[model samples]
Target: MSETTLDTRTVPHDMDAEMAALGGMLLTPSAAADVAELLNAADFYRPAHQTIYRAAAALMDRGDPVDAISVNAELDKLGEINRVGGAPYLHTLAASIPTAANAAYYARIVADKALLRRLVETGTRVAQIGYTGEGEAAALVEDAQAEMMAITSGAEPEEDAFFRSFMPQVVAGIEDRANADTNLVGLPTGLNDLDELTRGFRPGQLITVGARPSLGKSTLALDMVRAASVNAEDPAPAAFFSLEMGRNELGERLLSAQARVAFTRIQAGTVDDADWARMAEAMPRINAAPVAVRDDVNDLRIIRSVCRRMKATTGLRLVVVDYLQLVETGERSENRQQDVSAVSGALKAMAKELGVTVIALSQLNRGPESRDDKKPRMSELRESGSIEQDSDMVILLHRDDFYDQESVRAGEADLFVVKHRNGPTATLTAAFQGHYARFMDMARG
Candidate 1:
């Protein structure tokens, strides 16, 4: 097949909307600043319109006049008068819009058309890559998804803005929160004490749950998933990406946790009549919950793909990765530490981009075990301290009896909030039932 060309492909665009937008700006120069927020220069389908928009945006930035004469002068200064049909095109644009009152509407139309064009171009590139069999298929898919997200979110480089421009949004958010009846400021973690301390997990937060082997890190993660997603009539949906465990095994653990049955018994298939009764009672809660578990996922791209799909379909709000070390970075790095650091940073960005709370389980290094206290600290976060730096909250799990059999805190675990970006940092204790693979709040007499 011959190389493809942009002219041959049919792309979605509205020339009238582009012209109207430019015309509105020309009619009312004051609205150029507002319109610039919605539509970039590239949003115009026609080259001349693109040039005109850029000139108008420049004039607005400089706080200068933005009429047809000024825009044509600016375009002439840039030596593109002949390329865009000189000052006549600018005059035509100014004459097109009846009023600047609908500037935002015209801008939206142009933006929507730009998004469609981006989809077509990206889809064609992805298809061509697939046909040519160039690069890794997974990487190609991930790149396509990233491009789609960029287009969907209208992501762009940050520009300097005055504090006065942003103060209204901040004040409005505070007023909204003040008017809200619920005290919880963010998504509920379903743990009362933890919720009281942190006000629950907020969106765009990368929370790390770190621990040594057999300290119930996975169990705690699963418990949090249940807390966030289950037991509500219409709970916020969640997904768990487990690289260490199988889906069936995680499901069994969920069943055990929900029914308060011994996980060992569930695994051994030796449930008695009483356990069967409890399991029957737990089935409805499990069935009504909106959560997905993918135990086979080891690649970050696949996890991202799953989260995006879930967010689009079920409106996902929380994501739990069983362990961080198990995630494949999809690129060859110099060392394991560098790879881990890269993955940690990517997970933080993913949380922000997806607008979800991401809880990633991590393994602590031997530094914690060598200490006399046996408590895991921030420095012990396994292969990379970047996990600590990237995370909005770092929770280190410690069960004393996991190391010492005769300790008094045998049935308890400590979730030490070593780092919390927006709230109090403290340890919250919970009752740990290893047999049932469940964590519960400790009862106070």
Candidate 2:
């Protein structure tokens, strides 16, 4: 078709009317999702674009004036909006929309956005208006069309398909890093070797730290949680889901661990000057870390809900469930073993689903008691069915003293890696100070 004919046919007789219709069409909840999907697929923008748009919207919502140049500059300042190729795309973006999540968020003050909703009511009309027979306008319209198509296609970006296939690998990496950052909020245990071995309890790994009651399972987890939160090269925010202990009790334990006072001593409140001095030295660091504890939730659903809420607020990277048995799985089957399996499996799956590492403290079966050595094995993890299958790593806590005093007086506890699915299986030793709930490296065990 000739340019004139194409122009007449393509650009509606009333340009304003056509733009209005397209805007209305793209804004519907479903339509908006479709529009977002298409744009994401056709061209890639830095993940920070989402951040920039959200920031811009917040500014606009507060009636702040952010002209295109100023907005782009602000994004550059915050490292949100980076280099854009050619021209006005960045400028156009600032002018056209505000963003909440997947949709083009617009201020209600922009009367056109309300109108845009109506225009996007039907795919046929959007296709016609956006296709622009042939030009820059056509390109923009096509992107909008693609976004609509993506939404209509009923695909979730976070689902495996979109994350693995459509989104850039960088997004996955960024997400992983963010997840890690959120999970490592507690202090580091100053065990360099252990930190190097596991990258400070990574995101999306269900690590079962199980052993007999006195073998330091909770101590090890708390120490690692505290250490990881504080001593990370890049710290990840963390939430401790201590089903067995109340928040106050957990806090006291942490304070004791930091203060180097025996947990019993702290409880007894017989603090000497030295213990008080040590606590003064440690409490500030312990208190300032980005660690949070949750003990109120017990039901599996409630636990998951609490976890999700934590993820929302703190960008949780790691979750420590203090002793798995304490979690009431609520899967009322005849077999408690089966019930335990479901709970363990759900924890592992949660690690993968939320992309957060879960260091789950677990109680050992009488298997440890039966064994002469009493060091835990993979099979020794109580409810091995799901815990064994779901865990990426399993470290069984075993104090020789729990079995024999020579081990504790020797300052030795074995962290037996019974299952290292991604790595090697070996045993390492850390000095367990039960009094303070702290674990120091054995250095030479």
Candidate 3:
């Protein structure tokens, strides 16, 4: 193919639509502000359009006027007026549009073309990766999926949601909290004190539960997952992506907790008549619950795909990852800490993108045990400080009995709300039933 032919065919763009959108923006500042939410300067295929839109956006953001003269002056300040064919081009754009009423429509045209161009670029990159054949077949597939997902990730943009546009949601949320009998605004976990303190797990919130080994991190996560998804009055399906435990093992934990049967007895097939009856009773509730379990997933791409599918089908509200450090990020980094930081950042992003509350279990360092009190803090999060930084809530699970076996608080576990972004922090106690792998509300116990 000739160079000119290839240039015309390869890049996807609509110059008429770009100019019309710019003209609309120049004529109507209100429409410009709303359209800016859907399209950025980079979304314009032409460099000149990008320059014009950037100048207009800067003026609008600063509460300055946006018009041909003002935008021209801003571009002149940016030394881009001559580069963009001078003030004549701006006038031409304004003259091209008949009216500013179709500003959003024109902006949508520009956005769609931009997305198509991005799709072409992503496909090209994927083809290049496939041609090399350097990585494993499975890894390559994952990489391709990740690349496509990265392009589609911002499908719903809230970046430019102004306060006036956002006030209705805020007011509705406040009214929901006020009219309710309880202060829990989000999905309740069936644990009263913890729910009160944290106001339930709000959507788009990333919650990290960390502890040393065998300190009930998994147990606590399971309890909360059950409460939010299965046991809640109106069942909202939730996802559990377990990298540390197999599906059967996790099922057994839920079974033990629900049936109130001993875990050892259940695992050993030593259930008596009464235990069998309890298991039979528990089976119906467990089967009825809308919780999806997946143990094979250890990467964010797969996790995101599963969550997206679940949310579309059954209205998924929460997602639980049994331990963060175990996620396979599919990238080779210089150190484990860097890999963990990347994973944490990805999980946080996933939570926001999917609009689901994510609870990821993490491992704490030995700093808690080294201290006299043996209570964990935010700094004890293992591997990555980014875990603490990215999370909206950091909950530290500690059992004094785990360190001092003969202490008076043998079965009591202290859940320290170390870092909560929206509420007060305090330590709430829950009864840890080791035999059942259950964490129960202390008041009930």
Q: Which number leads on lDDT?
A: 3
Candidate 3 wrongly placed segments (more than 4 Å): 1-160
RMSD in order of candidates: 14.8, 12.2, 15.1
lDDT of each: 0.84, 0.62, 0.86
lDDT tens readout by residue for model 3, 1-445: 3222233475889999999999988887655654675688889999999999999988875667778999999999989999998999999988988888888788899999999988998987897788788879999999999889877676555765668887988899888878988677788876788987888898899999999998989888899977876677876678999898999999999999989999999899998999999989889878998889899999876787677645543557889998899987888787999999998898888788667899999998889878999988889899999998999999899999999999999999998999899988898998889999989888662
Q: Best TM-score goes to which candidate?
A: 3
TM-scores, in order shown?
A: 0.66, 0.60, 0.67
Clashing pairs in 1: none
Residue 356 C-alpha lDDT in model 1: 92
Model 2 agreement with the true structure over 1-445: per-residue lDDT tens digits = 5233222223113323222222322233332322322222112123334354444444433434434555566666666564442125554443343332323222221234323433444455556555565557867676667667753464555555655575677687667768774333223435655555654555678888888776667767777777677555656678788777788877888888777788888888898999899989988787767788887776776666556545544456778888787778766677778777878888988887677888888888887777687656677677656888888888887777766766535567777778877667777777777767788876564
Q: Which stretches in model 1 have alpha-carbon errors above 4 Å?
A: 1-169
Q: What is residue 388's positional error in candidate 2, in angstroms?
A: 0.8
Superposed model 2: Cα runs more than 4 Å off: 1-190, 231-235, 407-409
- Write model 1 residue lDDT over 1-445, tens digit each, in one string: 7676556756899888888888888887445644675688888889888888888878765557788889889989999888998888788887887788787788899999998898888777767776777788899788768876876675664453668777998899789889987777677765677888887788899999999987889998888888778864447799989889899999999999999899999999999999999999999889888888887789987777677656544567889998999999889777999989988998899899778999999999887779887988898898997999999999999999988999988898898999999988998998988888888888888
